[model samples]
Target: MGRPTPDYRRYRCTIGGEVYTVHLNPRHGRRLLDLAIATGSELVWATTWEQYANDWIAPRIGLPSLPVIPLTSDPPSEHGEMFKTPHVAAYAGRRPFVWFDDQVWAEDEEYLRVRQGLADFLLIHVDPMRGLTSRHLGMAHEWLTLTGFSQGS
Candidate 1:
Protein backbone atom coordinates (compact mmCIF):
# COMPACT_ATOMS: atom_id res chain seq x y z
CA MET A 1 0.00 0.00 0.00
CA GLY A 2 2.86 2.36 -0.75
CA ARG A 3 4.51 3.18 -4.05
CA PRO A 4 3.33 1.42 -7.18
CA THR A 5 5.71 -1.35 -8.16
CA PRO A 6 6.48 -3.14 -11.42
CA ASP A 7 4.77 -6.19 -9.97
CA TYR A 8 1.47 -4.38 -9.43
CA ARG A 9 -1.40 -4.41 -11.88
CA ARG A 10 -0.68 -2.90 -15.28
CA TYR A 11 -2.81 -0.66 -17.45
CA ARG A 12 -2.04 0.03 -21.07
CA CYS A 13 -2.05 3.61 -22.29
CA THR A 14 -1.99 4.97 -25.84
CA ILE A 15 -2.53 8.68 -25.62
CA GLY A 16 -0.89 11.64 -27.40
CA GLY A 17 0.97 9.32 -29.79
CA GLU A 18 2.81 7.78 -26.86
CA VAL A 19 2.40 4.18 -25.92
CA TYR A 20 3.25 3.02 -22.42
CA THR A 21 2.08 1.01 -19.46
CA VAL A 22 1.11 2.24 -16.02
CA HIS A 23 1.23 0.22 -12.86
CA LEU A 24 -1.17 1.30 -10.15
CA ASN A 25 -2.27 0.34 -6.68
CA PRO A 26 -5.65 2.04 -6.70
CA ARG A 27 -6.37 1.68 -2.99
CA HIS A 28 -3.60 4.04 -1.99
CA GLY A 29 -4.76 6.67 -4.47
CA ARG A 30 -8.37 6.26 -3.44
CA ARG A 31 -7.54 6.65 0.18
CA LEU A 32 -5.44 9.73 -0.39
CA LEU A 33 -7.99 11.39 -2.63
CA ASP A 34 -10.78 10.63 -0.21
CA LEU A 35 -8.88 12.22 2.63
CA ALA A 36 -8.10 15.28 0.58
CA ILE A 37 -11.70 15.72 -0.44
CA ALA A 38 -12.97 15.17 3.09
CA THR A 39 -10.65 17.87 4.34
CA GLY A 40 -12.39 20.45 2.07
CA SER A 41 -9.83 20.55 -0.69
CA GLU A 42 -11.39 20.77 -4.10
CA LEU A 43 -9.93 18.38 -6.64
CA VAL A 44 -9.65 19.31 -10.26
CA TRP A 45 -8.01 17.66 -13.21
CA ALA A 46 -5.12 19.68 -14.61
CA THR A 47 -3.53 17.13 -16.80
CA THR A 48 -3.33 16.26 -20.46
CA TRP A 49 -5.62 13.46 -19.47
CA GLU A 50 -8.33 16.14 -19.29
CA GLN A 51 -11.78 14.54 -19.41
CA TYR A 52 -10.19 11.15 -19.72
CA ALA A 53 -9.16 11.42 -16.09
CA ASN A 54 -12.81 11.58 -15.10
CA ASP A 55 -13.71 8.89 -17.58
CA TRP A 56 -10.98 6.46 -16.64
CA ILE A 57 -8.56 7.29 -13.81
CA ALA A 58 -11.18 8.57 -11.38
CA PRO A 59 -13.23 5.43 -11.50
CA ARG A 60 -10.21 3.23 -11.00
CA ILE A 61 -9.04 5.38 -8.13
CA GLY A 62 -12.56 5.58 -6.61
CA LEU A 63 -12.90 9.32 -7.20
CA PRO A 64 -16.02 10.98 -8.44
CA SER A 65 -15.94 13.01 -11.63
CA LEU A 66 -13.98 16.12 -10.74
CA PRO A 67 -13.89 19.37 -12.68
CA VAL A 68 -11.41 19.47 -15.55
CA ILE A 69 -9.22 22.46 -16.19
CA PRO A 70 -9.60 23.33 -19.83
CA LEU A 71 -6.18 23.54 -21.39
CA THR A 72 -5.49 26.03 -24.11
CA SER A 73 -3.31 25.93 -27.21
CA ASP A 74 -1.43 28.92 -25.83
CA PRO A 75 2.32 29.02 -25.92
CA PRO A 76 4.57 28.22 -22.99
CA SER A 77 5.12 30.72 -20.23
CA GLU A 78 7.62 33.49 -20.87
CA HIS A 79 9.43 32.42 -17.72
CA GLY A 80 9.77 28.83 -19.00
CA GLU A 81 7.22 27.17 -16.76
CA MET A 82 5.29 24.17 -18.00
CA PHE A 83 2.84 24.85 -20.78
CA LYS A 84 -0.02 24.19 -18.43
CA THR A 85 1.23 26.56 -15.74
CA PRO A 86 -0.42 29.62 -17.14
CA HIS A 87 -3.76 27.91 -17.51
CA VAL A 88 -3.45 26.48 -14.02
CA ALA A 89 -2.64 29.86 -12.59
CA ALA A 90 -5.60 31.40 -14.37
CA TYR A 91 -7.94 28.69 -13.20
CA ALA A 92 -6.74 28.94 -9.63
CA GLY A 93 -7.07 32.73 -9.83
CA ARG A 94 -5.71 33.92 -6.49
CA ARG A 95 -7.21 31.08 -4.47
CA PRO A 96 -4.85 28.94 -2.45
CA PHE A 97 -4.28 25.55 -4.06
CA VAL A 98 -2.22 22.44 -3.89
CA TRP A 99 -1.19 21.11 -7.25
CA PHE A 100 -0.10 17.54 -7.74
CA ASP A 101 1.61 16.45 -10.87
CA ASP A 102 4.38 14.20 -12.07
CA GLN A 103 5.89 16.91 -14.24
CA VAL A 104 6.02 19.79 -11.72
CA TRP A 105 9.27 21.76 -11.93
CA ALA A 106 10.98 24.61 -10.16
CA GLU A 107 9.90 26.97 -12.90
CA ASP A 108 6.29 26.09 -12.28
CA GLU A 109 6.73 26.74 -8.58
CA GLU A 110 8.38 30.06 -9.27
CA TYR A 111 5.64 31.09 -11.65
CA LEU A 112 2.97 30.28 -9.09
CA ARG A 113 4.94 31.97 -6.34
CA VAL A 114 5.07 35.18 -8.31
CA ARG A 115 1.52 34.89 -9.64
CA GLN A 116 -0.21 33.96 -6.40
CA GLY A 117 1.66 36.51 -4.28
CA LEU A 118 0.69 36.06 -0.63
CA ALA A 119 -1.69 33.16 -1.34
CA ASP A 120 -0.37 29.89 0.02
CA PHE A 121 0.11 26.88 -2.20
CA LEU A 122 1.87 23.57 -2.30
CA LEU A 123 2.99 21.34 -5.11
CA ILE A 124 3.31 17.64 -4.61
CA HIS A 125 5.38 15.91 -7.23
CA VAL A 126 4.39 12.35 -7.82
CA ASP A 127 6.89 9.98 -9.33
CA PRO A 128 5.42 8.69 -12.55
CA MET A 129 6.96 5.31 -11.95
CA ARG A 130 6.50 4.96 -8.19
CA GLY A 131 3.10 6.65 -7.80
CA LEU A 132 1.71 8.35 -4.67
CA THR A 133 2.42 7.37 -1.07
CA SER A 134 1.29 8.08 2.49
CA ARG A 135 4.21 10.46 2.83
CA HIS A 136 2.70 12.53 0.07
CA LEU A 137 -0.57 12.60 1.97
CA GLY A 138 1.37 13.51 5.07
CA MET A 139 2.77 16.53 3.25
CA ALA A 140 -0.69 17.57 2.15
CA HIS A 141 -2.11 17.10 5.63
CA GLU A 142 0.72 19.06 7.14
CA TRP A 143 0.16 21.89 4.71
CA LEU A 144 -3.53 21.79 5.42
CA THR A 145 -2.84 21.95 9.14
CA LEU A 146 -0.48 24.88 8.78
CA THR A 147 -2.98 26.63 6.54
CA GLY A 148 -5.84 25.94 8.94
CA PHE A 149 -7.73 23.80 6.45
CA SER A 150 -7.47 20.71 8.60
CA GLN A 151 -9.82 22.38 11.08
CA GLY A 152 -12.40 22.51 8.29
CA SER A 153 -12.14 26.10 7.23
Candidate 2:
Protein backbone atom coordinates (compact mmCIF):
# COMPACT_ATOMS: atom_id res chain seq x y z
CA MET A 1 0.00 0.00 0.00
CA GLY A 2 2.70 2.43 1.07
CA ARG A 3 6.37 2.39 2.02
CA PRO A 4 7.07 -0.36 4.53
CA THR A 5 7.71 0.84 8.03
CA PRO A 6 11.36 1.50 8.82
CA ASP A 7 12.83 -1.62 10.41
CA TYR A 8 16.22 -0.29 11.51
CA ARG A 9 16.57 3.28 12.69
CA ARG A 10 19.39 2.98 10.13
CA TYR A 11 19.73 0.24 7.61
CA ARG A 12 20.60 -0.35 3.96
CA CYS A 13 17.26 -1.56 2.63
CA THR A 14 17.14 -4.67 0.53
CA ILE A 15 13.60 -5.97 1.01
CA GLY A 16 12.28 -4.13 -2.05
CA GLY A 17 15.02 -5.33 -4.35
CA GLU A 18 17.57 -2.68 -5.49
CA VAL A 19 16.50 0.18 -3.23
CA TYR A 20 18.66 1.05 -0.24
CA THR A 21 16.85 1.06 3.10
CA VAL A 22 18.91 3.62 4.89
CA HIS A 23 18.42 6.25 7.60
CA LEU A 24 20.89 9.01 8.37
CA ASN A 25 21.60 10.00 11.96
CA PRO A 26 21.18 13.77 12.18
CA ARG A 27 23.50 13.91 15.14
CA HIS A 28 26.15 11.98 13.30
CA GLY A 29 25.97 14.00 10.11
CA ARG A 30 24.99 17.49 11.24
CA ARG A 31 27.89 19.01 9.37
CA LEU A 32 27.27 16.79 6.37
CA LEU A 33 23.54 17.28 6.81
CA ASP A 34 23.60 19.31 3.65
CA LEU A 35 25.73 16.70 1.94
CA ALA A 36 23.40 13.91 3.01
CA ILE A 37 20.31 15.89 2.11
CA ALA A 38 21.70 16.63 -1.33
CA THR A 39 22.36 12.94 -1.69
CA GLY A 40 18.67 12.13 -1.04
CA SER A 41 19.38 10.68 2.39
CA GLU A 42 16.94 11.03 5.31
CA LEU A 43 17.56 12.76 8.61
CA VAL A 44 16.10 11.90 12.03
CA TRP A 45 15.76 14.27 14.94
CA ALA A 46 14.30 13.42 18.36
CA THR A 47 12.74 16.80 19.24
CA THR A 48 11.08 19.74 17.55
CA TRP A 49 13.11 22.82 16.85
CA GLU A 50 13.45 25.70 14.43
CA GLN A 51 13.23 24.11 10.99
CA TYR A 52 16.88 23.75 10.28
CA ALA A 53 16.03 22.10 6.99
CA ASN A 54 13.66 24.83 5.84
CA ASP A 55 15.92 27.56 7.10
CA TRP A 56 19.59 26.61 7.02
CA ILE A 57 20.50 22.92 6.87
CA ALA A 58 18.12 22.23 4.01
CA PRO A 59 18.90 25.26 1.85
CA ARG A 60 22.57 24.48 2.14
CA ILE A 61 22.14 20.71 1.88
CA GLY A 62 19.10 20.93 -0.47
CA LEU A 63 16.59 18.72 1.41
CA PRO A 64 13.85 18.96 4.00
CA SER A 65 11.64 17.34 6.73
CA LEU A 66 14.63 15.10 7.00
CA PRO A 67 12.40 13.52 9.63
CA VAL A 68 13.26 14.03 13.27
CA ILE A 69 13.42 10.88 15.43
CA PRO A 70 12.01 12.63 18.56
CA LEU A 71 14.22 11.74 21.49
CA THR A 72 12.92 10.60 24.87
CA SER A 73 16.38 11.03 26.40
CA ASP A 74 18.99 13.74 26.77
CA PRO A 75 20.93 14.83 23.68
CA PRO A 76 24.42 13.43 23.37
CA SER A 77 25.73 16.94 22.76
CA GLU A 78 24.56 20.46 23.48
CA HIS A 79 23.92 21.11 19.76
CA GLY A 80 21.99 17.99 18.74
CA GLU A 81 19.83 15.11 20.00
CA MET A 82 20.98 11.70 21.11
CA PHE A 83 20.44 8.46 19.24
CA LYS A 84 16.90 7.16 19.76
CA THR A 85 18.54 4.01 21.06
CA PRO A 86 22.21 3.80 22.05
CA HIS A 87 22.56 0.06 21.25
CA VAL A 88 20.69 0.29 17.95
CA ALA A 89 23.63 -0.34 15.67
CA ALA A 90 21.37 -2.26 13.34
CA TYR A 91 19.83 0.95 12.04
CA ALA A 92 23.26 2.30 11.20
CA GLY A 93 23.52 -0.45 8.65
CA ARG A 94 26.97 -1.81 7.79
CA ARG A 95 28.26 1.57 6.67
CA PRO A 96 31.13 3.14 8.54
CA PHE A 97 29.23 5.93 10.18
CA VAL A 98 31.05 9.04 11.31
CA TRP A 99 29.58 10.92 14.24
CA PHE A 100 30.66 14.23 15.71
CA ASP A 101 31.45 14.15 19.40
CA ASP A 102 33.98 15.14 22.02
CA GLN A 103 34.42 11.42 22.68
CA VAL A 104 34.39 8.04 21.02
CA TRP A 105 31.61 5.40 21.08
CA ALA A 106 33.14 3.81 24.15
CA GLU A 107 36.16 4.94 26.06
CA ASP A 108 36.86 1.61 27.71
CA GLU A 109 36.12 -0.85 24.92
CA GLU A 110 39.11 -0.21 22.61
CA TYR A 111 36.62 1.45 20.26
CA LEU A 112 34.76 -1.27 18.41
CA ARG A 113 36.44 -0.68 15.02
CA VAL A 114 35.18 -2.54 11.97
CA ARG A 115 35.69 -2.50 8.20
CA GLN A 116 34.47 -4.76 5.40
CA GLY A 117 36.26 -4.19 2.05
CA LEU A 118 39.16 -2.46 0.32
CA ALA A 119 37.48 0.82 0.99
CA ASP A 120 40.03 3.24 2.31
CA PHE A 121 38.86 3.46 5.88
CA LEU A 122 38.15 7.18 5.88
CA LEU A 123 36.70 9.86 8.10
CA ILE A 124 36.44 13.57 7.32
CA HIS A 125 36.90 15.18 10.71
CA VAL A 126 35.73 18.81 10.91
CA ASP A 127 37.03 21.24 13.46
CA PRO A 128 37.33 25.02 13.23
CA MET A 129 41.03 24.89 13.99
CA ARG A 130 41.97 21.25 13.71
CA GLY A 131 43.17 19.23 10.76
CA LEU A 132 41.13 16.54 8.97
CA THR A 133 42.36 13.94 11.40
CA SER A 134 41.05 15.75 14.44
CA ARG A 135 40.05 13.48 17.35
CA HIS A 136 42.40 10.94 15.81
CA LEU A 137 39.34 9.45 14.19
CA GLY A 138 41.45 8.57 11.16
CA MET A 139 43.66 6.64 13.54
CA ALA A 140 40.69 4.59 14.58
CA HIS A 141 39.68 4.17 10.96
CA GLU A 142 43.20 3.07 10.21
CA TRP A 143 43.06 0.64 13.09
CA LEU A 144 39.89 -0.88 11.73
CA THR A 145 41.35 -1.06 8.23
CA LEU A 146 44.62 -2.52 9.43
CA THR A 147 42.85 -5.18 11.46
CA GLY A 148 41.76 -6.66 8.09
CA PHE A 149 38.19 -5.66 8.79
CA SER A 150 38.35 -2.93 6.11
CA GLN A 151 39.95 -3.49 2.72
CA GLY A 152 40.61 0.21 2.08
CA SER A 153 39.14 1.17 -1.21
Candidate 3:
Protein backbone atom coordinates (compact mmCIF):
# COMPACT_ATOMS: atom_id res chain seq x y z
CA MET A 1 0.00 0.00 0.00
CA GLY A 2 0.96 3.70 -0.32
CA ARG A 3 0.59 6.71 1.99
CA PRO A 4 -2.57 8.65 2.75
CA THR A 5 -1.42 10.98 0.03
CA PRO A 6 0.72 9.65 -2.78
CA ASP A 7 2.67 12.92 -2.86
CA TYR A 8 3.60 12.49 0.78
CA ARG A 9 4.64 8.90 0.17
CA ARG A 10 8.34 9.54 0.65
CA TYR A 11 9.17 12.80 2.46
CA ARG A 12 7.41 14.83 -0.18
CA CYS A 13 6.89 18.45 0.96
CA THR A 14 3.39 19.93 0.86
CA ILE A 15 2.61 21.49 4.24
CA GLY A 16 2.95 25.03 2.73
CA GLY A 17 4.14 26.60 5.98
CA GLU A 18 7.32 28.29 7.08
CA VAL A 19 10.06 25.75 7.47
CA TYR A 20 11.36 25.94 11.02
CA THR A 21 15.02 25.33 11.80
CA VAL A 22 15.49 22.00 13.54
CA HIS A 23 18.47 20.00 14.73
CA LEU A 24 17.99 16.42 13.74
CA ASN A 25 18.76 14.04 16.59
CA PRO A 26 17.09 11.82 19.15
CA ARG A 27 17.02 14.87 21.44
CA HIS A 28 13.95 16.21 19.67
CA GLY A 29 11.96 13.47 21.38
CA ARG A 30 10.32 16.01 23.62
CA ARG A 31 9.14 18.16 20.76
CA LEU A 32 7.69 15.03 19.23
CA LEU A 33 5.99 14.21 22.50
CA ASP A 34 4.52 17.70 22.72
CA LEU A 35 3.21 17.31 19.22
CA ALA A 36 1.62 14.01 20.12
CA ILE A 37 0.09 15.43 23.28
CA ALA A 38 -1.15 18.47 21.47
CA THR A 39 -2.72 16.26 18.87
CA GLY A 40 -4.22 14.03 21.55
CA SER A 41 -2.58 11.01 20.02
CA GLU A 42 -1.12 8.32 22.19
CA LEU A 43 2.65 8.21 22.01
CA VAL A 44 3.94 4.72 21.30
CA TRP A 45 7.48 3.46 21.37
CA ALA A 46 9.39 0.37 20.44
CA THR A 47 11.64 0.78 23.45
CA THR A 48 11.79 2.22 26.93
CA TRP A 49 13.97 5.08 25.81
CA GLU A 50 11.09 6.24 23.66
CA GLN A 51 8.41 5.53 26.24
CA TYR A 52 9.64 7.81 29.04
CA ALA A 53 11.44 10.13 26.70
CA ASN A 54 9.33 13.07 27.80
CA ASP A 55 9.31 12.26 31.51
CA TRP A 56 13.01 11.56 31.87
CA ILE A 57 14.70 12.30 28.61
CA ALA A 58 13.11 15.47 27.21
CA PRO A 59 13.10 17.24 30.57
CA ARG A 60 16.87 17.49 30.46
CA ILE A 61 16.46 19.05 27.06
CA GLY A 62 13.73 21.28 28.58
CA LEU A 63 10.60 19.69 27.12
CA PRO A 64 7.49 18.50 28.94
CA SER A 65 6.18 15.02 29.65
CA LEU A 66 3.44 13.20 27.76
CA PRO A 67 1.33 10.05 27.76
CA VAL A 68 3.47 7.36 26.25
CA ILE A 69 3.31 3.63 25.59
CA PRO A 70 6.35 1.40 25.41
CA LEU A 71 6.47 -2.03 23.86
CA THR A 72 8.60 -4.92 24.98
CA SER A 73 10.85 -7.03 22.86
CA ASP A 74 8.92 -9.59 20.90
CA PRO A 75 9.44 -13.21 21.78
CA PRO A 76 12.49 -14.98 20.38
CA SER A 77 10.13 -16.84 18.10
CA GLU A 78 9.17 -13.55 16.45
CA HIS A 79 12.78 -12.97 15.47
CA GLY A 80 13.29 -10.27 18.03
CA GLU A 81 14.01 -7.00 16.33
CA MET A 82 13.92 -3.97 18.57
CA PHE A 83 13.66 -1.59 15.66
CA LYS A 84 10.85 -3.52 14.06
CA THR A 85 8.14 -0.86 14.31
CA PRO A 86 5.17 -2.83 12.96
CA HIS A 87 5.18 -5.00 16.04
CA VAL A 88 5.77 -1.91 18.10
CA ALA A 89 2.80 -0.21 16.51
CA ALA A 90 0.62 -3.25 17.08
CA TYR A 91 1.56 -3.01 20.71
CA ALA A 92 0.33 0.57 20.65
CA GLY A 93 -3.25 -0.61 20.21
CA ARG A 94 -5.80 0.73 17.77
CA ARG A 95 -6.18 4.40 18.51
CA PRO A 96 -5.88 7.76 16.84
CA PHE A 97 -2.12 8.03 17.10
CA VAL A 98 1.21 9.49 16.15
CA TRP A 99 4.49 7.63 16.56
CA PHE A 100 8.05 8.87 16.39
CA ASP A 101 11.54 7.57 15.87
CA ASP A 102 13.92 7.43 12.95
CA GLN A 103 11.72 4.42 12.12
CA VAL A 104 8.66 6.18 10.77
CA TRP A 105 9.18 5.00 7.23
CA ALA A 106 10.53 1.76 8.54
CA GLU A 107 7.06 0.94 9.78
CA ASP A 108 5.41 1.10 6.37
CA GLU A 109 4.59 -2.56 6.56
CA GLU A 110 3.04 -2.12 9.96
CA TYR A 111 1.16 0.97 8.90
CA LEU A 112 -0.22 -0.87 5.91
CA ARG A 113 -1.09 -3.89 7.94
CA VAL A 114 -3.06 -1.84 10.41
CA ARG A 115 -4.49 0.96 8.31
CA GLN A 116 -7.99 -0.33 8.41
CA GLY A 117 -7.81 -0.98 12.11
CA LEU A 118 -6.94 2.65 12.88
CA ALA A 119 -9.09 5.66 13.33
CA ASP A 120 -6.25 7.96 12.33
CA PHE A 121 -2.52 8.11 11.81
CA LEU A 122 -0.27 11.17 12.11
CA LEU A 123 3.25 10.66 10.94
CA ILE A 124 5.73 13.46 11.64
CA HIS A 125 9.31 14.15 10.81
CA VAL A 126 11.49 16.98 12.09
CA ASP A 127 13.99 17.87 9.42
CA PRO A 128 16.55 20.55 10.15
CA MET A 129 16.98 21.31 6.48
CA ARG A 130 13.28 21.22 5.53
CA GLY A 131 11.64 22.66 8.65
CA LEU A 132 7.80 22.43 8.52
CA THR A 133 5.54 22.41 5.45
CA SER A 134 1.84 22.23 4.59
CA ARG A 135 1.98 18.43 4.66
CA HIS A 136 3.65 18.59 8.00
CA LEU A 137 1.04 21.08 9.12
CA GLY A 138 -1.58 18.89 7.48
CA MET A 139 -0.23 15.90 9.36
CA ALA A 140 -0.33 17.85 12.58
CA HIS A 141 -3.85 18.91 11.73
CA GLU A 142 -4.75 15.32 10.98
CA TRP A 143 -3.16 14.35 14.25
CA LEU A 144 -5.15 16.98 16.05
CA THR A 145 -8.30 15.76 14.40
CA LEU A 146 -7.60 12.20 15.41
CA THR A 147 -6.23 13.28 18.75
CA GLY A 148 -7.09 16.48 20.63
CA PHE A 149 -3.86 18.35 21.17
CA SER A 150 -3.98 22.11 21.62
CA GLN A 151 -1.36 24.62 22.68
CA GLY A 152 -0.75 24.10 26.39
CA SER A 153 -4.06 22.51 27.10
User: Would you list the C-alpha lDDT of every candidate in the order shown?
Assistant: 0.76, 0.36, 0.47
Error of 3 at 128 (Å): 8.9
The deviation in Å at residue 84 for candidate 2 is 7.3
- Which wins on lDDT, candidate 2 or candidate 3? 3
> In candidate 1, what residue range of length 10 has the lowest lDDT sum?
1-10
Compute the lDDT of residue 146 as modeled in candidate 3: 42
**Candidate with the larger TM-score of 1 and 3:** 1
- Let me know the TM-score candidate 3 reaches against the reference structure: 0.45
lDDT of 1 by residue, 1-153 (tens): 445675457778777788766675768557766767666777789988889777767777678898999987786568877888888888888666778788888888988887555357788898886777778878887787778775456
Q: After superposition, how far is residue 87 of candidate 3 from its true place, in Å?
A: 4.8
RMSD of each: 3.0, 15.4, 11.4
Candidate 3 per-residue C-alpha lDDT over 7-103 given as tens digits, one digit per residue, 9 for 90 to 100: 2212222223633222323434555556555555554434444544454444544455655455556454232223445554565566445544343
Residue runs of model 2 more than 4 Å from their true location after superposition:
1-56, 64-70, 74-90, 100-125, 128-153
The candidate with the higher lDDT, 1 or 3, is 1
The per-residue C-alpha lDDT of model 3 at residue 134 equals 47
* Models ranked on TM-score: 1, 3, 2
